[model samples]
Target: MREEKDARIIKREILPYLAPGIAKLLWGKDDKFFAGLEEIRLRIKSPLILKIGDRDYTINRRGEITTRLDDAYVVEGEDIYRSIASISDNSLYAFEEDIKKGFITIPGGHRVGLAGQVVYKGNNICILKNFSSICFRVAREIKGCAKGLLPYLIDKNGQIVNTLLISPPRCGKTTILRDLARMIADGIHIPFPHNVVIIDERSEIAGCYQGVPQLEVGVRTDVLDACPKALGMMMAIRSLSPEVIVTDEIGREEDIASIYECINAGVAVIATVHARNIEELERRVLFKELLKSKSFGRGVVLSRRQGPGTVEAVYRWDD
Candidate 1:
């Protein structure tokens, strides 16, 4: 039943934005196939590819997975154009700003990455044109995924601790962060519900589309979609008065400055970074400084040994 629901979600949320022929090709795939689907890539004059886990598989015209490149369906320029049109609601101009950023967040919180000719305005990007490749990254909401980490994130006083989640790319850092936000905001294992704010720089945490979250972040959560981390943290502090601020992929110096500001304001912060382990994180100058400051009360390391979001270890920094 879960697989069936996942398949339905993909069909309803992601397929419509794809080219008609491509959508038709994927529509007939079995529920189990869709349940494990992670990403879909379409490149002009290239074979259509589907990513499941860490492996990529080519798809044939008959909606079946194939190992032969010759049997795989080749994407075309027309398909790319149609897909762009569908995703943009036929008004590509309206999404020009997002397109300029190389991706757009669709209704289901799924992100479609675009790559093509870069139109430059002086030193900055003006727009993207003549799309050649589109990668659809499916977003899945795995509620309660962060349940085990709650003990490490909460203190004896029931207050949420300043936590950092460390993981490499595609290891479910965002997914875990999302679930943590939900659990903390909803007071799942804490004393009571608290105001949670998500600084969604890339719209990946809450997967907000048009100022509303498409995923289940929580009732007490407020999201700042597509906003810079530093600016969003200040905004949440000044306006939202969040008790807990959640953000992903924080390593920039400016981000560190904002984290200190959050700490001074007595707001708990839950953030993630791309690091294989604590040793790797400590090796980086910025992260080393962060560790020296002792800003994070706890650190949780994740990996893909068992699967994405596999918690390898949790460390209490204050200890």
Candidate 2:
């Protein structure tokens, strides 16, 4: 029943943005395809692609991906428009801000990546036009992924530690972050729950739809969905009195500065950054201040060597 429910959610949230023919083609596929489906890529004049697990397949017009050119389905501009209308619910103006960011979060926490011409005004992106491509990244929550890291994130007193997750893109940084947030909020591996404020800049961590989180973050977690990390961190600190502040993909100078402030305020932080390993993390000029200050007492590195969310190594500041 749970699996069926998940499938229904995906179909309802994602299929509307697809052209009728393409939608029918995808819906007609075997259940196995949807079981591990990760992303759907649509490019104008190019083949329709599906990313399932770690493999990519090009879907044909007949609802099958094959080696023969005749079997491959080519995407069209009309498909793009139909998808845009579907995603925006026919009101593109309402999502102008998200479009400028090159992505929009549909219901069920699904994210649609957009690409096309960019319109800028005074060094800021004002609009996106002439859409040519779309990538729908399906969101999944693996509840136990954070269990392995719980030992490292908690101390003897049952207090959450100041931790930072490091990984390259597609290494499941956000996935682990989401899981940890749940664990922290639920008091898993700890004596009692802590107040956790999530600065969910991309809405990926909490998957908020209409201001409500679609994913299970935990009973004690408060999410600032789609809010900038830097600003949200400050806001969480000032108002939430959080014992732990959680966020994903921290790279900006302002973000680091805010983390410093949070640490000084005695709030433990769990955050992620883009880096292959400890050495690379230390070498980055932007991260130098935080690294030198030892703001993050513990570090967890992730990779796809085994699979997404694979824990390569865990480090302590004194290590």
Candidate 3:
């Protein structure tokens, strides 16, 4: 059943964006290979690479994994062009804004990261051209992943405390945050449901594609996809009247101010940041004031020591 699901994901979500021959080659691989798949990298004039778990492997022309560089399948420029065409639906101009942002979020919440010549309009990036490499980062939803953290996040009054999730990249912080949104919206482990709003700056938390979430974020959740975090939080407060606001990777000065506004509005907040531990988070100039003010009632540290989403420690600021 797992293999079948994995195959279906690769077929529906991944293969369509690959070149025809390359897609056929990948489809021939065993289902188990797709099960642990995390990323697929396509580079012009380079070997096809796959990142599974913590290790990287090269794919040969025969659809087999090999360590020998000479045995690997060399990706051609045509493959890159064809994949880009497919990803953009043959209209690259239509995705100009997304391209400028360096990635395109496809259906199933998969993010295709682009690399090549950067086009500049004045001081800001105008667009990307001469595409040379693309990375497909798979987004997987794990329901009930936040169960263990419920006790730490929820207060005795049955309301969620202002919380911050700290983790390094690829530690499943986004995955855990997604599940936390769902559980909070659905009233899981809580007394009643709350109107939860997700400020998805990168479209990672809700995995929203074309303004609709591809992942399950509960029946009552509202997502503001691709909006700036600080702006989105204020917008949600004014229009959505959300009881709780969730966002990922909040570190900017404006983000801190907006979080303060949310607190003043009597809305709970759940946000994530990139940090290996509390000490590292404190060393940052921006977060110092937030920590001193005790804006977050609880802080959860996550790591990949056991696996992705592993909870390392939970700190109570009020203590």
The top-ranked prediction according to TM-score is 1
Taken over the whole model, the C-alpha lDDT of each candidate is 0.93, 0.87, 0.92
Tens digit of lDDT per residue, candidate 1, span 28-127? 8899999999999999999999998888888887778976888999999999999999999999999988998899999989999999999998999999
lDDT of 2 by residue, 132-177 (tens): 9999999888888888789887877888889989999888999889
| Model 3, span 1-319: residue lDDT tens | 7767877897899898998878888887788888888998999998888898898888787877876678898999999999999999999999998998899999999999999999887899988999999999988888889988887888888899999999999999999999989998998988888999999999898888899999999888999999999999999999998999999999899999999999999999999999999999999988978998998899999999998999999999977
Off by over 4 Å in 2: 1-6, 67-70
> Over the full model, what C-alpha lDDT does candidate 2 score relative to the true structure?
0.87
Worst 10 residues of 3 by lDDT: 61-70
Q: Where does the lowest 10-residue lDDT sum fall in candidate 2?
A: 62-71
- The better-scoring model by TM-score among 1 and 2 is 1
Instruction: Supply candidate 2's per-residue lDDT for 247.
Output: 94
**TM-score, per-candidate, Cα-based:** 0.98, 0.95, 0.97
Best first by TM-score, ranked: 1, 3, 2
Q: What residue pairs clash in candidate 2, if any at all?
A: none
